[model samples]
Target: MPKARAITIHRHFIEPGTDWNTEDFNFSDVLSAQGSSGDALSITPNFRAGAAPENAVGGGNLVDIFNAAAEWWERAILDDFDLTLNFGWAPLGGGTLAVHSLVAQEGTPNRETEGTIRFDNDGSSLWFLDPTPDQNEEYQTFTETTTTQLGGGDINIGRVYTDPVGDAIGRFDLLSLAKHEIGHALGLSRANRSFRAENMDFDIDVQAPRPFPGTEIPTRNGAHLTLNTSLMFPFFVTGERKLQSGIDILANAEISEFNNINLNPVHVPEPTSTPLILSLAMGVGTFVKRKSLKRQSGL
Candidate 1:
C-alpha cells in the first residue's frame, strides 16, 4: 500500500457554518515543495460534530465538538500526520495513532472578570470592554488562554485575540477566528506578538509549561521557531477586506503539501519516453507475428 500522505481538516462548527474561504488559505501551497521533492502529502476534509461545549448539553443537542474534533483527527490525519484541524468548542481526549489534534479555546470565565484589552475608534483601551453586561453587549472580560492539553487530552485552541464583545458587536467571525487559533494550536508561535511588521515588539511568551511562564516564542523566526501566515496572525484584523496575509501563508502550507501528492511531478514519466518504449516492444511483436504467419501459410 502507498504511504499515508495527507492532512485532514474537520469542521466542528458546521451549524454556524465556517467563515473560512478555503481558497484564501491556499491549502495546496505548503505541499508544493513536498510534492516536488518527493515528500508527497494530501488533504482530506472531514465534516463532523466536534463541538463539545458544556452549554450544548441541553436540548441544544449540539454534538460533542471537543470529542468530535478528537475523533475527526483520529479518522482523518492520525495516520496521515501532515496535520488535522478542528474549529469549535474545546478539545478533550488525548492523541491517537491516526490523528493530530487541532482545536480552539472557546470559554473564558477568568478573562471576563479581570477585564480585557481592545482596539476601537482608532485607540487602544485597557478597560473599555469590562465585565459589566451592557445593553448592546452580552459578555465581558478577557481570559489568558494557553495551548495545552485538557486533562492530558488534546490541546485546546488558545484564544490569544481578546474580544469579549466581538460576537455581539458583529465584529468577530468565529470560523476565521478559530482558524487562527488552530494555527497556533498546531505549531505557529503562541506568543502575544502580532505578525504585523509594526507591532512586532509586543511579544507574548509561548514557551515554558502550561501557564505560559516567562519565555515567549520570539516573533523572529529562527532555527527553532517558524512563522505562520494566516490572517489569524496572533493579533486581530478589523479592516474592510478582513483578510490577513498570514491566512494565505497558513493555507499555502497545507495546500503545498496537498498539491504534491495529487500532482505527482517526480514519478510521472516524460512524454517522449512513453512512445519510444512502446514502439520498440511492438516492433518485435510485429516481426514475430509476420514470421509465424508466413510459416503457417507455407510460403
Candidate 2:
C-alpha cells in the first residue's frame, strides 16, 4: 500500500432558491478535442459496498452515471494517467449531497494521486437518477431555511435529468453531481497547489491596471470558485445541471500544465470570456486532516 497524506474532503451541498434553466449546453461541444496527440485519461472506479449499498437508489445505474462523469473529463483532458476512484454510500452528515476525498501523495502534501467519493444515504433527501434527458420544464423553486455542513434545508427532489435543459424540478441530478465531484478529483480545487498557483496568477493578471476583467476569488474555505458557473462551484441547486464551463477547463488545464501534461485546448474558452452566473445560497466547507494515513488497499 502507498502512504498518503491526510484526506482532503470536498463536500457538495443542495441550496434553496436555485432552479434549473432552459439552456441546452453539451459538454462535448465546448470540450471537444483540440487535436492533441496525448494519450487519453483513464479513470477506474471501484464501487464499494461499505457503510451502505453502492447503488441504493432504485431504477438507475450509479456506475453508469459515474462513468459518464468521467467521460466528460476524459474528453477535455488528454493526459495519460490512470486514476482510481473508490465510490461508496454513507451518512455524510446533514446538508451534504456527496463528498470527494483526495488521497495525497506520500511525503508531498500538495500532490494528489487518487480519491474516493461517497454519496449521502442518510435519508435526509430523496434521490432520483434520470438516465435520459427530459424536455419538460415544470420545476419548482426552493429556499434554504437552515444551513448545515453539507447544505441542510428544504428541497423537493422529485425528478432527475441527465442533461441541463430538462424538466427535473425538485430533484437533484446525479450526473451533474458526479461531474462536480470528479472535477475535484482532477485538480480543479484550491486545495491543490497547482490550482492555487493558477488562481493567484489569475488574480494578479486582473488586478490594478491589467486588462483582465475579473478576479479568481475562492469561496468555501479556498476550496471552490466564487461567483462563477464552473462545475466546481460549491452550491448545487435542486434541479440545475451544470456542465464544465471554460473556467473549469482552464483550471484543470493549469493542473495538467503543472504536471507537464499537455491538454487539448481547441474549444477551451478564454478566461475573460468566462461568465458569471447566479450565486446560489449554501454554506461551503472543507475538512482537511492534519495527520497522514496509510493508503487503503485498491483505492
Candidate 3:
C-alpha cells in the first residue's frame, strides 16, 4: 500500500511576458458549510490568529468573498467527503500571491484528504476586497478599468458587479484570487501524479485539438496551465476577476473522477448566478417560508 504524501505549490505574481517565480502561501481552520446533498463536497475554513483582519468592505465583510469562493467550488464538485483547509496571511516573498498545500495518497489516482491555502499579506500589494453584487444590480454597476500588456497589446482587466464599484484600479481581485487558490486546494495541480494522469485522460476523452503533438500540456511552474485563459494560470493580472472557464471545470472534473468522486460540471454557475446560489446555500431563500410557518398555528 502506498502512503499518502503532502505537496505544496506556490502561486506567484508575474508581470506580463515575465517568467514565473516561486513563493510561500498559508491556511488555518474554523467555519464549515454543508452542500445541498450529503454527497456534495464540503469545505471547512480555518482562519489564523491575527493574520488578516475581518475588515468591512462595500456592504459585506471581507471573509464573505472567501466563503463565496469555497461555495463556488462546492457547487461544482459532488463528493462524499469534507475538505478541511487552514487559511492565513503571510509574507510570501516577491511576486507571490498565495500558496496551497495538499495531502493525497501517492498512486496513479490519488485521493486528496485535506489542504491549506495562504494569501500574501505582506503589504507589498494592494487588494480589492469587495462583495459581488446581485445580478439585478449589475446593469448600473461599474468597475474602474485597468490594463496589462499582453501579446504586445493592452487588455482590459477590470471586472464589474463588485461593490464600491469603479474602485478596482491597480488592485488584485480578492475573490478571483481566493477561487484560484481554492482550485489548487481541491487537487487541481500538475505536481500531483493523479492530476497529471487525469488531465491527460481529459484531453484524450475530449479529443482536445492541440496546436502541437505532445503527451503533456504546457504549464507554468508545473502547476498552472499556460495554454488557455484558466483560473489556474500562472499570472493573475491586476484588476482582473477570472472565473472558472469550461476547461478549468473539466480539468477539475477529470481529477475528481480519477479519485472516484462525482462531479456536477453542468451545475457550475455563472458569475451572475453566484449571489442567488449563495443565498440558497445560507437558507436566505427559505426565510420567507420559515417565517410564514412560524406565524401559522403552532403544531
Which should have the higher lDDT, number 1 or number 3? Answer: 3
lDDT per residue, candidate 2, 35-97, as tens digits?
102225555576663332343342455666776666666656654455667665656555677
* Candidate 3 residue lDDT tens string, 1-299: 54222222222222223322222222221111111133255566665422442331234333566666766666566544556665556556466766666644343346455565556656754666665621212122232222222221222222232232244555566777787777776656545556666555344122222111122323444556553345666666555555554345445545544232222232212333223221122122211101000111221
- Candidate 2 residue spans exceeding 4 A from truth: 1-39, 50-58, 106-111, 133-167, 189-191, 196-220, 256-299
**TM-score, one value per model:** 0.26, 0.55, 0.56
Task: Give model 2 RMSD, 1 decimal.
Answer: 17.4
Q: Write the residue-wise lDDT of candidate 1 on 71-121 in tens digits.
A: 322232222333333333223222110111323221211000010100111
> Which ten-residue region of model 2 has the weakest summed lDDT?
27-36
- Backbone clashes counted, model 1: 39
Compute the lDDT for candidate 2. Answer: 0.45
Whose TM-score is greatest here?
3
Specify the poorest-scoring 10-residue window by lDDT in model 1.
110-119
